[model samples]
Target: MPRLCGRRGNIRRLTRNSQLVQNRWLNRSAEDQLTDNENLRNQIAITRTNESQEQRNERHRVNTLRQRLARQRVTDTL
Candidate 1:
């Protein structure tokens, strides 16, 4: 019983910490967010540039499937 209670308390503490981190990110200025997004896009572009043709094809196929599934889900919910 005591062990279970301790686990619950730890879970609550972790949840609170994650919420605090999310709130901090949301509170950042618009310029800061834009810069972060630009940096991420640049990183992704660099990574894609290094990938071989096979890897690029696989990534494209996976992305296409994901988009198709997402669209199907949206249509189902409508």
Candidate 2:
């Protein structure tokens, strides 16, 4: 007999005289929401892939540059 959201007896009372006058709220256009959802998903996926590629490229560039600088420093110091 325990209710779900910690309101045990409240839902039981509401069910007794329910005329269902609580479900009339249009928040936004469904088409706009759908388009927005699709756009967001695509943007997230593309951004993630671009970021991964950029990270890999940056690592390669940094390692290559560091090695060249280190070799030059060693030759110059010796």
Candidate 3:
């Protein structure tokens, strides 16, 4: 009999990969993490500077919504 592979199998593979990546990041040295964060902030600043006003507004709106939802989740868990 042939085995059936579907969404469940794909999800398991993805979850495993995500956990591995998270573990690697968590294991990185403090200095390496600091450097990575600085580079990320610089890239974000450069991208924001190049974005149009409309794009900036949309990004800000999305970010605000994300933060609100995140806060709701934390409150719900408390």
- Preferred candidate (TM-score higher): 1 or 2: 1
Write model 2 residue lDDT over 18-75, tens digit each, in one string: 5353332235578867988999999978876778777878878999999999999999
Candidate 2 colliding pairs: none
Q: How close is candidate 3 to the true structure, as a TM-score?
A: 0.61
In angstroms, the error of model 3 at 72 is: 6.7
Q: In candidate 3, which residue pairs clash?
A: none
TM-score quality measure for candidate 2: 0.34
lDDT of 3 by residue, 1-78 (tens): 656578645745667678899899889999998999999999999999999999999999999999999999999999
Q: In candidate 1, what are the lDDT values of residues 38-58, reduced to their tens digit?
A: 999999999999999999999
Candidate 2: lDDT of 7?
Answer: 52
Model 1 gets an lDDT of 0.91
Per-residue error at 59 for model 3, in Å? 1.6
Considering summed lDDT, which 10 consecutive residues are worst modelled in model 1?
1-10
What's the number of clashes in each of the models?
A: 0, 0, 0
Which run of 10 residues does model 2 get worst, by summed lDDT?
Answer: 16-25
